[model samples]
Target: MEHSHGAHRADDIEDARIKDLTERFRQTLSTKRMNELVSRSVSRASSPAPRDFGTPQPPPSVSDAQLPTYSSLRNIPLVPQAPQDARSLRFKNMLHSLSNMPIRWENPGLLDEALRVVPLEQIYNEAEEESQILQAEAESLGAGKKAAWGYQDCVVRALLRWFKRSFFTWVNNPACSRCYSPTIGVGMAAPLPDEQARGANQVELYKCSVEQCGAYERYPRYNDAFVLLQTRRGRCGEWANCFSMLCRAVGSRVRWVWNAEDHVWTEVYSVHRKRWVHVDACEEAWDKPRLYTEGWGKKLSYCIAFSADGAMDVTRRYVRNVSKHAVERNRAPEAVLLHIMDEIRAMRRSNMSKQDKFRLEGEDMRENRELRSCVISSIAHEVSKLSVEDIMNGRSSRSRADPDTQKALEGRTSGNSEWIRARGEGGRGQPNPQDPRNRQR
Candidate 1:
């Protein structure tokens, strides 16, 4: 029995040794195979193949021949068409004139002066606090999380809050200085020599509403952003102009957006977000492109954003649903409008360095993508809200409008009710022709 137990232990030891040897052999084989592969790869990379001149080569493969040509698949580049008709010429000329707005604010000395009014310390403090809070929120979310906005974005937000609440004032009608009575609009007035010198192109005339204490007041419409720093009050034009300049004063790239519906706003390019953010100094709104149409319940025809760098027709950003919110864009042909935009962009970037022009072109492409995405997103949202029954019945989604949009349709809040109604911004109602918003400014 002892001999048998000793034999069994010997056999177990032998078996363990054999298994260990098998594993070592397997590892050795793997290492040898890997070395061979590496050597082959190195040799192939270092040496060119020897061609057999005596032997005929096989015909080159035409695998891609069946595929569509690149040009066939891609859209043709749009060739800008020059304006041929009277209306189109007028439209082009007007756009050219309006394109000069941002260029006027490019004075370095004036921009420095513009900064003096801003409470820099307060703005910076607010921006820091907001950025820190955003960072903390992002950290709390988890690893690889990013803050909603960067420091610069926070700075702009802070500036916007300060501008609307503390700096700028909205004026519909100038009050009588004599008795401080409410005034009535009495049509346009000529800008005084000093007013013209200070860049007031047009002046509005107003009379005191009081019967006995009749007083006349002149409200000059100053186009100069520097002059606006002192006067500090006007309609949408003045608000957009001044606020845009202030944005530039803080080293932000800015655009003055002109809407054909007789309203204007500012667009600040957010480097953090890689897009232009819609800012309305009048409404103190940020990134709400749908404010005019969705909030004010007004139809928009055109929304052209002009910058010192270039210009873009950003109508699609505001009027998401062409059938609903877009009015007739009949001022110029689509091709003519494209030509006008190209002309403005060329003029703006004519003096820029090649690298700067390239950078701006890239930005334009990115913004175009963003604008396209907006339309697509709006469509998707609408489709998502559609019910099977509604689709079958071919019913509109009026009753099922987006809750957020419906809430925004609470009417224009900036101006008085009478003014709002007069401008056709009261709600989704017909515009009063007597107080046309598109009246010459």
Candidate 2:
């Protein structure tokens, strides 16, 4: 009986050893295959130039005269005062034309003209000041000055810079005709997926499609304030916000303007030109000239007819239509939201010293922080697939209590044996008692 029992135990040990060896051999083969696969992928990526998104256009040959002056503005005016009577006259004329015209995207240079009369020097100064303040604030927060401002105050300020620089440019050297076409804005909200929809009224935030692991995220919610096709994703409003936030981080005062129909766009003040100019950052074609019509001929052969004028005309056509309701609102012409944004711009004027801006930012930052926290929290909670804490802590599976939570736990406290042991002891949710990882050390 003793020999029989001993034989059975020996067989069991041999069987277990064989199974273990088989698993080890399989794992070794699998690892080798994975390495080979990775090597092939790397070779392919480095083998040839990546496929271009669109046909590459030849760089525009430039003459000495055509070369742009990269001049920097030294003196920014504190106040931009336009001739009030001239402004009134133009406003009345624009109002009359708007009343008679059909609702269209082109305004025949009405709003464009009024915006031009704005003292460019003053706008430039303010935009610059605001831009500086935002940079400083980012630094104070212990966030890199170039770090993107996801919160409301910094985001809004950043937006102001983008708008001023892009949308407010002089048509002529003397600054007679100005354009304010901001094609898009981007808003950064927490991951608000579809599960938390409130019936038919839920807003969804979408992620960027580009693969380069960027930290930027945008929410494409429609606002009735801008006059564009309200898409749930990839609209001008979201684009403008994205640009604004980025510009602010780098130091600039910008703002977004949407048509009455809620088609959002943007403008930014040029401290050098002392005026507002249009910027269309969302235009995906990076090789194209910054100004419209300059590089369009290469894109479309038929554009030769009136390519330069055609691009301008095409752009103005949209602007005119955006101001369709301006006449109905009277010469008083209160774009209430724009007016508020304008005030923020004014606060950044060159006339105001850096110290003054610091004061304004101090106040703005407090209010902005509160507003942004609320927005981010609300969006995260209301969206429903995730929890607010999960997004805040960069934890996975905030939306569902599942395998993802375990994965997140491992990631958050990797290499901490004490934490793993403690987690195992008192419900998995508890923190490890002796986790040196959690200590500031």
Candidate 3:
């Protein structure tokens, strides 16, 4: 019985060895086939095409200048380089100061307190309904399809709607409290004791428009997001600040995006999409990066997004067509700008764990890729517009007329016409002399 068992074990071992050899042989054959296929493809590409008549003609030479250049913010590398000039150093300091805006909203206690004013039940109900509709729509399309936006995104959308329509008030100039008359700008004023106590650093002095009731009204600009909760009224600055804090209160990672052209917005990190989405609380716009450029006909120089964890130059996302929408980025040298970003990122991540740092680094790499793709897509769109005849004749395609002029003519929906025109955001119109872009900040 022992001899029989030994013979069976030997047979089983031999069978296993044979199976292993067969698998190895199969893999070797597959690799050889793949190598042969690759070699053939390479040879075909390198070799001249088969002669149709006599000899194969060499390909026509194309000048480097003829090649389309897709300009984008990706051209700026993240290599750290110190500012060499005074101007660049000043720019860096200014950006560092602005970067502190997001950190102010990081108070967990304050964020919790801010949530007390929000109608959570109503917001959640709206978000749930929207998310369900989106899910159903996705499923209706087919299997393996995903919803347009996640539940969290729906929640933000609901918040945006509520904040814009019902909660926040847009004040061009505050109306007179006693007489309810409109007020005209009378210039800057000192913050009163009560205003200073609530974090108002600057106050605007305005006189009642009515000559009879020329009472001076004080409009304190509160920098604190928590204070903004109680007031709930101002321009884009107040809107973005308060709404971004509210978004954080509801568990969304937020960024305070500052535009050099005197506009501010919010960016909410979409965990589901693994990307930061643009949200303009003033316009109630979600994920529309081009709203300022294409929608309002404004040329953007800088759009920096500052989050608690880091900062990013998101100009490429907003200015896809550099020739059309981008202004000169002369604030700092590209290298110095990169260094500033790295410094801010390092400072913010200083206290973070190794795992968290690794995760953020990965996210940064992904975002860089996304920004690069934006440039590529824009180039592709431009190339698609070029006809074969135009390319062959070495003439460029005629520029397409602005098709969205009518839409742009709607102007900035958030502010009054005078204010919009003053800011040069009045769609297709002559340049405003008082455009903030023309002035030094």
Candidate 4:
């Protein structure tokens, strides 16, 4: 019985060793067996570590599906940005989107149709050329062209071009010639002699149409046509209308006036000279009484009541004396002197400054209107009292007469000695002899 127990224990130990040895052989022969054993042993000891999805995912790598791949945009040439000027910062916003902006027609909903029909480049080029031509023509006419016809032609052409598109839309009636003629006299048209019309004789070219036509007591009547040629003879209103009509007809500008003490007149803009010319045709038609002495010589007065440019009003008495030639030629002291006085009087009325008023008052007092009106009965009284030398020399009179007035009478005389002196010196100076400033200086 003892021998049998020892044999059983030895066999049991031997069997366990055999089982362990068999498991090791199995592991060496196959990976599945090794894994099963490892799994069973780890499970019995501790659970195997589990994989976690909570671990942060790495950033995605570039791939066909994730990346923006380009075949064309990458190859396009980049436009260089323009260097900005500091001073041009104001225009930055205007230019910022210019490159990216698509062309847009100014009229809404027009782009689709305009792009199809209009040649933008051709239209632009043509417009530029036309503007150039207009500029060139305007440049050709500089400041101060003395010729009236030249001024009229240029003004008319400009008007035609400026209003070309509006021509058919509106029309103005052509004015009658007689309605525009300058004459306050009431008389039939008695055409002047061919010689007088042509200004042939040394006699004054301007004579009252009524007088020249030998219309006794009938006087002269103004029509539009006569006013243009004789701007100082028409009725005040007629003269103004005629002058304004002529100027506006050819696209020049003019202003008309009818004040209480004065007759009608116009101020026409002279484009070439950049100044206005006064026109008072009504004043020119009065009869000028002729006066002559064998020794003193023939003295004529051109009775131009007002300057075409609105500078002064020639007195009615003086206007009846001179010939048209005397006026156009700048002859006749009485006419010029009276005109200066008229301007001075106007200045006196318009001056607002007390100092200016006081100065003008002193000048006005010297005219001796009160004393002369009491003493002098006739037109000749004032003129005859003035010595020929005084008239010619523009000599200042102290007998209650203004020296400034005297100087004005001498139209463009040595009183403006500096102008002549400057001319002699050949300086680029032009002193306006008519300017009161030149006289004051």
Candidate 5:
């Protein structure tokens, strides 16, 4: 009975305290004061937000330190491939193998030996003259202006001329050792142990045309640029390999471009231009990206340029007119190619600084923009080039004939539409009635 009375007393005290607090709260919410508070709340809510004086804004985009890179601005997926299937794995392996070709040039002794065959004096003289002329021209323009082609560029140009006109020999067929007669093509032959040891992955078989002697000649397609320096003769592969090595020896950044169409060429980085400049040593052509498609009337699929520093797709560099000149890129999926590119890029740049990596990424973005512009500019040029008469006639103007044009036309005779026209291609690769075997520089 005593416990029950104490509990009731405690409950009564709690209720009395609650009632007192409620009455105090009610008094605080009285008529005029409540109205003033509500009006202030409404005004504050209805008014514009105050400026954030405490917070700092993000810095501007970088493009030469101006516009942000696409990758930086967005989180769009690159769609990289994981390569689970057997086919994708096989393709990845082959590309990895092909990627090793440029890495071979990194051997200092190999590059030194490759340069021994070059006429350094002649090349240097010509380069100096050209460089001086370019410098003078730039000076005439105004102060702070730059030359068209840098001194290093002129050196490569001079070396290219010397390489084509005087140094390297384009071998359509190896002269038979037995009778010294230019040999006729029999077919491809398996590489001999000696040839394989010397770095030939494939060999071409040729039989002497002479009736008296049936001597079979083996022309091993040596991939080694050092061996090429000694032989001084081969198809586009040899030309590009030897020339690119020499370019490296002469102290300019160079790339060996491999095409799926059995063509190969060189691209030297022109520091003056801040880009890779196209150079086809076989045709003695420079900066003519459309020469294969436009002049030779061919289409291209993959044009991969590999260097010691990196590898790039570069298909856009060569094939500007996709509708007319691009072959189906069916070797691998686009995502797989992107993945491969990323892998190679990361491998090459694994050791670089954050700032260096950022700079290169910026450079890559700029190059991509430039390449895209090429397609646009090419389309615009084609549209503007077409005359009313051409529209009526259904024909476009043809480029004038030149020495290179003749060679490019010769390359077209291969008639392998799935592939493309290139050096050591055309009827020259086969038994022709014209006997293009005799035509060598």
Candidate 6:
């Protein structure tokens, strides 16, 4: 009975403290507003308050840029609610598995050795020329204005061109080492002595297609970037791994980005831009994050970029058209992802100075805002593109946009522009068939 009385006394004291705070808050309001608030408080004290559904729309006087500043505290979600259903557990498991890929590139010695094979002279020369062109354009625009791409960005861009065109080969199937004929898939084999030494945990065995010589060939899937230098060809995995290592060699901080849909890419930190710039060595692409979704019509659920320092769910940078390109994000709840990111960040930054941590936190906040802005920009672009009929009818009437959507948006209209006089599209002679000039001609 004594303990229960003490607990009641404690509750009374807490209520008194809360009332004091509320009284002080009420005193700060204007006289007219305070009167109104008092009347509403009295009314609410008598009756239960009604629930609110939609948040208030911004007033007409407020501009789009000012919306963030004007956002009310009430707009923030306070309760910790589940973002997605339990169906997303599978996606979460896959991301955990994929996280291992980027961890492999942390070896400093291996990255340095990967540098030896890169054609430095050619890459540097190309970067210099491109930098000059960008500088000239910037000069023409105005004084003190920066060029679009920095020297380091141009360096990576040049390296990308050389890496994709001159160095890396896309391996769809292993060709016969003995007869130079196409090979048929024979099945998986245990790694040979040399292969295991060179970091190939798994080896694929292939047999020559020609009946005259049934020679079995070993195609080792080398994970080491240094080993990749000798082999010089692979799918998206090898391309991102080797190229990211080369970027690190050139003194740029790099991240190996893994996509949920079995794709991989790279993101290089640009000191000049104060942000991460997307680079894909396989496609010879630089700073085109929307390439997969907009250009290739690929749907993506997660695009996690992992570095030696940390990891991030950088899905927003790539999947701009959420309605179209967004896959089911349910692999785990958003809170779980947040916890994982925080854990990784704490582990990575544990030894860092307070000042350095503050700076990185600021960068993270800025990047978060930038990602949110991208969603807004994409929505605005889509709204602008919507036809009058679509708005009126509340449905789309026009045909779907082309798979090669970046051509119109990025001014990179032709994929054939890659330095190869190949048998098919992006050819020099044929203008984009979509172009009116080509149709008229």
TM-score leaderboard ranking: 1, 3, 5, 6, 2, 4
Q: Point to the candidate with the largest lDDT.
A: 1
lDDT of each: 0.81, 0.35, 0.81, 0.34, 0.74, 0.70
In candidate 3, stretches whose alpha carbon ends up further than 4 angstroms from where it belongs are: 1-78, 391-410, 428-441
TM-score of 1: 0.79
TM-score for all models, in order of appearance:
0.79, 0.22, 0.79, 0.20, 0.71, 0.70
Q: For residues 1-441, could you state the per-residue lDDT of candidate 5 as single tens digits?
A: 999999999999999987865555444334324444444444646654333222222222211333223342121233465566777777677777677777898899997786777878988999999999999999999998889999899999999999888888877778899999978888778888989988887788899989888799998888888888888888777888888889998999888887776577899988889998999898887787766776665567888878776678888887876887787887777768877877887887899899988987876787788888888876776686667888899887543333323433434422233223323234322321222322211
Instruction: Give lDDT tens digits, candidate 3, residues 56-119.
Output: 2222343345433434423422344678899998999998988988888889888889889999
Residue-by-residue lDDT tens digits, candidate 1, 323-373: 778899999877689889989999999999999999999999999999999
lDDT of 2 at 168: 28
lDDT of 1: 0.81
Rank candidates, lDDT, best first. 1, 3, 5, 6, 2, 4
Stretches of candidate 6 exceeding 4 Å from the true structure: 1-106, 387-389, 397-405, 408-441
All candidates: CA RMSD (Å): 16.9, 29.0, 17.3, 43.7, 19.5, 15.2
Clash totals for all candidate models? 0, 72, 0, 49, 5, 4
* Model 4 backbone overlap count: 49
lDDT of 4 by residue, 1-441 (tens): 999999999999999887865665443334433344445445546776334212232223322354233434322322222224443332222222221111111223333332333343443454455555655666678754234323343443333232222211111111223333222323233435543453222211122234334322222233333322343332334334443444454345554432222233444444454433444332221111111101112222222222222223223222222332122433223323343445434543573567766754553354235324323443344455677778789984324442222311222111134433432311112221222111100
- What lDDT is reached at residue 199 by model 3? 81
lDDT score at residue 412, model 4, on the 0-100 scale:
19
